[model samples]
Target: MMRHPFVLFALGTFAVFLLLHLAGGRQYVGVLSGTVVGGAGGAGLGLLYALAWFGAVLAAPVLLLAGLLDGALARASRARP
Candidate 1:
């Protein structure tokens, strides 16, 4: 089966969430507590937050580098005979 990067990212994010829930109970509780006071809603809200955080933390850097590499390659190709 072919697994896309988004699928992998989501699965990895959920796995990290589960691991943290199990191992970093206190820290997770603190985060949840803050979110609760800030009026964060159900699992959907949490998932959205997780996805956004993962995108910012992980995906953004990779995307930025890909863009930079693409630009550099294009510039190099244009400069070729």
Candidate 2:
């Protein structure tokens, strides 16, 4: 849903993983693979997975804050009469 920014970020990260896998199996193929950074690419996935995980974790709080703010605004407006 449009209200869930974390989901969008997660999907985007997954898309990146797919792209990396398509480009070639890790092994410092380029700046795109996590192997280039000396990470979990040994299994053909590292950077992209970590990125998606962190992005979602971080975005969850932001999404929650936005929801809280919107709810507060609605309640405040209703009390104005």
Candidate 3:
């Protein structure tokens, strides 16, 4: 929902993460920079790894926070009337 922008962003990032993994980016994910060198495929894999890492580390937290905020807002609204 537009009201919960973070929830949407997190969900979108998570979907991208899943897509990266499904595209055979698992081995490439969580790897250090310069670990794999050479070719266009290598470059693509590196990008995928970066995206997946962000999705896991960044989006997950945002999603949790969004849920917490949504719940708190719900409670506050309910208490008002």
Candidate 4:
């Protein structure tokens, strides 16, 4: 399971997002809403946070599904004697 590339990618994406979120990335995300929590310097941080967030939201699910399909195909192939 862990050997699957898609799964690894999804997990990695989620982990990065989790780390950023834990480190107060949420505050920076307000930049998107015109809040500007930390001024100009924060804009970059907010962008990073936003990218990670979007990746986790958009790519993660597709990666997970690809991983699942890959795993299932591998299993099916192995079962064919």
Best candidate, lDDT: 4
Tell how far residue 7 is off in model 2, in angstroms: 11
Residue pairs of candidate 3 with colliding backbone atoms: none
TM-score of 4: 0.86
| Candidate 4: residue 27 Cα off by (Å) | 1.0
**Candidate 3 runs further than 4 Å off:** 1-3, 29-31, 67-71
Clashing pairs in 2: none
Q: Name the best candidate (by TM-score).
A: 4
User: Where's the lowest-lDDT run of ten residues in candidate 1?
Assistant: 24-33
TM-score of each: 0.47, 0.39, 0.64, 0.86
Candidate 2: residue 27 lDDT (0-100) = 42
Q: Write the per-residue lDDT of candidate 3 for residues 1-81, one digit (tens) a residue.
A: 344667677767787777877877766643455566545676678677687778778777778687769878987999996
C-alpha lDDT of all candidate models, in order: 0.53, 0.54, 0.71, 0.88
lDDT per residue for candidate 2 within 1-81, as digits (tens), equals: 344454454566556655665654444444353335544453435444444445545654575667666667777999998
Candidate 2, residue 42: Cα displacement in angstroms equals 7.4
The model with the greater lDDT, 1 or 4, is 4
Ranked candidates, highest TM-score first: 4, 3, 1, 2
Candidate 1 Cα errors over 4 Å, as ranges: 1-40
For model 4, where is the 10-residue window of minimal lDDT?
38-47
Candidate 1 global CA lDDT score: 0.53
Model 1: per-residue Cα lDDT over 1-81, one tens digit each: 314454455556656655545543323233444554223334445555555556556875575556566667777999999
